[model samples]
Target: MHFVTGGAFNGKSAWVKAYYHMEAEAVGNWFSGYRGDALPEDLHSAAGVIVVLEGIEQWVKELLMEHDPKSAQDMWHAALEKWLQWERGQQGRVVCLIGSDITKGIVPASEEERELRDTAGRVFQDTAAVCERVDLIWYGIGQQLK
Candidate 1:
């Protein structure tokens, strides 16, 4: 699994598409009304294919707003665990996770917003720890982190 992270409009998605020889449609928009308890089952079929999971922070924000903290955490952990499993199972496939870096700006006054930022940061940290490669994009340039 490869993790591509940057601020909005940083060209992470474009880089992933070109790097993997994938069209825009090949990238899964996981944040498109994607409120769910489990990771999409069809991802299993993505084996030997290049799949990009975009807007992961959006999904996490939705989860946090819709559920209690404990429930949201459970769902978040489950989702990450499922993704990790799928990534491990992909022998010839590529899984590129694209998320915005939300920890760079000023701290939010609202507790909910702060929680979302913290959650996203933690998720990104965990994902990067296990990913085979990690890239941090800034001003359209990718700096390899792992």
Candidate 2:
């Protein structure tokens, strides 16, 4: 799977969309979303392309707070690890991920903000292990990490 990750506003989504459109036109198939919240299940059926959003650490932290605030960090780790294992079980296919930069938020003055940043960094590290290709984008430049 290909991972498109970088700091905020790096245009990962735009890049993904452009690739999807170009691929669709070249093959005459519809691009769809699968495996994430942004798209529907019909995407898995079309077979052209599937692009999905991976959770930014902040979102995971917020979810933990909503579900179990006392042990949010532990929960985020367990949940994310489980989800990654499940995704890996899908055999072989191109899985593209869009992620946010969580480390930059460490400067926030609130406890929640700190936790979000930490959680996000951890999530990114965990997901990176599963990626076959990692691209870092900065100011419209793409750098391959894998």
Q: By TM-score, who's the top model here?
A: 1
User: How close is each model in CA RMSD to the real structure?
Assistant: 3.2, 5.6
lDDT of each: 0.72, 0.57
Please provide, for model 1 over 1-146, each residue's C-alpha lDDT reduced to its tens digit, 9 standing for 90 to 100: 78899998888777876777666544343322223423453576553556667777876687787886567666766766776777667466666778888888899999999998988888788778768899998888999989
Give per-residue CA lDDT, model 2, range 2-120, as digits (tens).
67777777776666667555443222222222222322222244343343444454456556566644365456456445545544656643556667676863388988777667666
| Cα error of candidate 1 at position 90, Å | 4.5
Worst 10-residue lDDT window for candidate 2 reads 26-35
Provide the lowest-lDDT 10-residue window in model 1: 29-38
Tally clashes: model 1: 0
